[model samples]
Target chain A: MNYIFHFGDMWNARGEFVEGALMTLRLSGLAMVASLVIAILGALARTSGPKPLRMLVAAYVEIIRNTPFLVQIFIIFFGLPTVGLRLDANEGALIALILNGSAYTIEIVRAGIENISQGQIEGALALGLHRLQTFRLVVLPQALRIIVPPLGSQFILLMLNSSVCSAISADELTSAALDVQGRTFRAFEAFIVAAAIYFALSLLFSTAFATIERLAFGKRISR
Target chain B: MRSFNAGDVVYLLLAARWTVLLSLIAFAGGGLVGLIIALMRVAQARAARWFAIGFIRVFQGTPLLLQLFLVFFGGDLIGVPLGAWLSVILGLSLNAGAFLGEIWRGSIQAVPNGQIEAARALGLHYGQRMLRVVAPQALRTAIPPTVGFLVNLIKSTSLAAIIGFVELTRAGQQLNNATFRPFLIFGLVASVYFVMCWPLTIAASRLERRLALAYKR
Candidate 1:
């Protein structure tokens, strides 16, 4: 048990670590926005669109949900080039994250939407709201309230999933740790530092989500 | 360079057996550990409960990739040297246990307090109450989420590839490197996973419906 722990290498590589963490944030943030958009559209399609469109969305969700994210990244990063749609590692990673994230998001949002009572939509229609207005004004706000907590957790999960992007050589935190470990041969210390940084990031994001929840739904619920 | 062939597909399909094996190991190990964790979470002792909470938090907070990396390499650094197979199983089991423990804890709590009181009035002891009354009902509630987590666990066994365990994903990488046909190779890889996981998803939903019928008012 005479293992010598070293943090000096990690300290010297702080710049790379910071850059990597920021890349993780950026990648997750961008994918978060993209996936939310896709999820909302996919959920809406599943809920009220034509039968064919709903089936299409359902199939997409099923396929994505059933497969591994690493394989999805590999397919996009490598497979897309064969069709003349070449993308860099970062772009490929972001697309994979969004594709995977949105499928779960669609299910969550659909559940939220379904949770709204039938009377609410009928009441909105009786109040002279059009179908679009009824959905926008009456249904969405309530669904968002029900959806926020799980959605926040999913976003955190997305942040963690971003680590898988390292498989394709994305310059994110996990890849940076791997690079450091290769250079310093301090795999243990390198990953420990990366794990600690990830823990901090999770805490930070959870607090931020709590604040957002308060600001977004606090007053409405309190009333 | 060789083009993709039937041999490559056979290589992948054969390699997928390792993926299935790793998943089974994770599920069995995780389920055993998770039951302990779930019980600890519900234990009256403050220390046991806090330890359970800390375990869930640490595992859930960090990436499974890092956990796998740590176990695979850290074991060597400490001279224990769990090779790729043992390391992958250990890492995936720990992660899955944390998630399953939490899911089961929720299901256990969801069981009606009235049922517990009824068991108490019948003069049942703690073990008898949990085993005969509570656990059966909690199990019904636990099945859907537990199966769902198992599906996710199967997909995650692919991560074992990073530590040089040549499962489905790693086998695909090898074939892709040699053939240089990513589309055909990776697409075949994904379909193999889909074939494996889609049945589990369907089974979970069927079980959910059966449980719903059993509980219907």
Candidate 2:
């Protein structure tokens, strides 16, 4: 306990931390949107597609879920080049995040989708809606209600998982901390600041999601 | 560049034991801490309950990588000098404790309040009420999620590589560097992780279904 706390070096390097936090938000936000799209499609395939397609989606989910994100990113960032897919670090990171996030989100979205009673879809069809329209107009909205809360948790997890992208030299918060700590040798202070930023970022997301839930659910009730 | 040969595969397999060991250490340590956190979370004392909440908030709110970095360096700052093994163990355990604590808290709370009242009416003390009546039911529900979290813990031990611990992931990285076969090496590493984790995932789901049936009774 003899070491005096010196925030001096990390304090001077606050710009790196700020830029890094912004980069993290940017990277995760992009991945969040991209993965949601993928998950929605994958869940559709899982729940309503042909037998072969369902098996394929199920296998993808199982493989991804059972493996580590770090290894998955390593495979994408490092492994793909052998197949002539030479993506830069950020592109690879985004791809990796989307792939990883969708596997989990597909399950979450699938759970939401399956929770809607079949009679509702039938009722929509009975009202002269097309099958596609029935899904979009009737099923999806109700499924979304059950889906939003878990989706929020998944997005928060995706944001935190973005820290792993730094291993591949992706320009995010953890890498930002790595740069400052490597130079300042203030590993303790450097990571503390990075972790606090992450903490704040997650808290912000949680609060925003809670507000969205309130508004969305309230609208349904009032209408 | 060397090819990813049998020796590299053997090396990776050997290194996987460290990953398993690290995971076990974290699980054991985290389990003990999680039990305490779960108890405190459900405790009547405001300070204990708040402490548990804040512990979960801080630990779960941040990424495990940063928490690893903190222990990996916070030790250096405090003159404790916990090197890679000690640091990864402590860091992963703390993070796992927060998650497992939350899971087990839900399980504990799932037990009916009337059951506790019934125990109290029967002149059962707090210890008797918890150990004899509540624990049996909570344990039935807790097993599935607890097993599920172990899969996550197993995958998470790969983070030890960042701290220079030569677990399976680091082994793969080193072999990939030597062989220039990232595809072969990391794929093998991931498959090894899959082999370890997939069975647990299956078991967890099975247990979950069985628990559901038990509750249905």
Candidate 3:
């Protein structure tokens, strides 16, 4: 077991890894924001809409929740290319993450929405507010408050799950580590660095989400 | 060109055996380790509690894929070289243990404080109370979520493909590469996972419902 330690390679390739980390952060941030918006709409559609819309949302949640994220990635990346719908690896990964995140988000958001008392909606309607406006001004605010802690955790999970993009050679942190591992034949060192970087990124993302939460709902909750 | 054949299906099913085996190993190994973690988390010592928290935070906070990478390659980098099978088991078990521990700790703490006080007043020691009183109740409460986590642990084993473990996902990757039938191959892969997970999901839900009913009564 002649082990040669070289911390220098990782330092030498720091720029590439930093670039990859930034890309991962960017992709995850955008996907999280997009999925949250979509989930808010989907949750509403599922709970209060027509039967057909409810069925559609239910099917969406069930299918995605039951399947593996890797298979979903393969469908978008490899399956789409055969139909002349090629996307680069990053785009494919982002699309997959966004789609996957939306289903779980819908479920979480729906839980929060259900926590809102039914009387609140009726009261808003009685006050002359329209259905959409009542949902916007009354239901969603309360739901979002109940859902914030879980929502923060979900965002953290998304940030971490973004590491899966390495499968498609998405030059993200894990892929960068793999590239360096291949070049240096230092698989252990490369992976340790990659794992630490991922942990650090997760911590950073959660802190940022907490800050955003304070800004977004701090006033409402206090008042 | 080899058309969609029965042989391919047989091969894929054969590969699924490893997936099932890996899941069992992970669950069995993780369950034991998780119990220890759970107990330690509820231990009176401050250091033990903090250590459990740190373990959960580190493992739960990072991607399983990265941990798999560390386990797979970290073994190679160090003197102790291991096969992918061993590394995958070790890595998945560690991650599963941390999460299961946290979940079980929540259940343990959820038990009424009065119950513990009653046990203590009856001259039962800490170990006696935990073994005879606290754990039995927590076990019933923890079953459903524990089962749910087991299902998730199984699905997550697919991430082992990145390290070339040749489980279901890797087998699907190999078939897809050869047949250029990503749609069929990966679709099959997902269906297999769905079949594997759906039963556990249903059972967990039923278990939770039963537990809720029992509590109400």
Candidate 4:
């Protein structure tokens, strides 16, 4: 088998690839932060709010979780324009990412919250800690620790799923690869390079999350 | 503007049929290949184990979207004869096999060592012990996660639309191009997918509980 060594072309395109990687990082980072906030609130509401509110939040989680993120992006980017809620492709894609990420996050956070022992809640109440304060100070911290690894994996998955934004013309890493490949007509080489870049990014983000988990939870070796 | 049409709805429903067919093909094909990989990883030979591990690592390390593009374009480059249906099925099955293999390996290991030892002491051969003693219990543990992954596989099939597969999402895109009614078209698309996936999700949870209760009893 012969190989085309196009180091010159790949070098010239390095700047474009870097720019696309930055955009991918920005998109994934913003989506992760936004979904973290939404998920906390959604999880809390689902666990403790009134019946109607709980049901509404549950519905939101189930609907988003069950549908494909690609379909959601299509709806927001392409479908929303018909309903007079037009947004540009990037905005639409970001919204869809946050919405989809939050659904999975809600489940993760709720599981964490539920893992807090009832005895701890009783201890807090007996000590006269307010309900909200107990949750904020005690239960949440422990729960977050329990949920950290899975949550990290979820964010990595989110970064990979962010490739769907390319389908809506968001011009991130995958889209940039598409453009370069079209211009060069070296589709195989372009995709191989692109897939390697994505795999590297995933490893980078996973390491970053592991560091963050260490910082947040401190080193308490349970095992 | 064209008025809302029942005919469009009928077309979307028909497209959903392809989505179901693609999911079945991927799941069945993936399951068979995954079984081989799982057994290979479980084999006493280190070379077989390492080869299966490397295969799973390469596929699992990459995203499904990239795999789809590689298969679609690589088919063109190599002069492989395949339509959208065959290409998507081949790509998704390979991806699913890697993941499901790892999942089953973990589940199989979760079965205690004593059970296998006891099976051997009872004069069972290695193959007989695995088939009669180990596999049945691992399969029970595997069912829930396997079902969850299958639901995910179904959703992932929507990516095939990018390569011109006329599944549910692609059909919605076609209708939207014609009617210029993105909201109605994609809303219908998302709902159809939700309807297809939600049952599996529920079934997975229920089976998980049942398995847990069965072992407890």
**Candidate 1 runs further than 4 Å off:** A219-223, B117-124, B213-216
Candidate 4: where is the Cα deviation over 4 Å?
A1-8, A211-223
Task: List DockQ, one per candidate, in order.
Answer: 0.81, 0.90, 0.72, 0.63
Better of 2 and 4 by TM-score: 2
Descending-DockQ candidate ranking: 2, 1, 3, 4
Show the colliding residue pairs in model 2.
none
Candidate with better DockQ, 2 vs 3: 2
Model with the higher DockQ, candidate 1 or 2: 2
Over 4 Å off, model 3: A1-4, A211-223, B210-217
* Residues A106-140 of candidate 3: C-alpha lDDT, one tens digit per residue: 98999999988889988999999999999789987
lDDT of 2: 0.92
Candidate 4 lDDT by residue in tens digits, B51-152: 899878777766788888888777777777577888899999999999899989988888999998899899999889989999998998999999999889
lDDT of 2 at B138: 93
Pairs that collide in candidate 1 are none
For residues B17-110, could you state the per-residue lDDT of candidate 1 as single tens digits? Answer: 9999999999999998898899999988999999999999889999999999999988898899999999999999999999999999998988
Error at A66, model 2, angstroms? 0.6
All candidates: interface RMSD: 0.8, 0.7, 1.7, 1.7
Sort by lDDT, top down from the best: 2, 1, 3, 4
Q: TM-score of each candidate?
A: 0.95, 0.97, 0.94, 0.94
Clashes of each: 0, 0, 0, 0
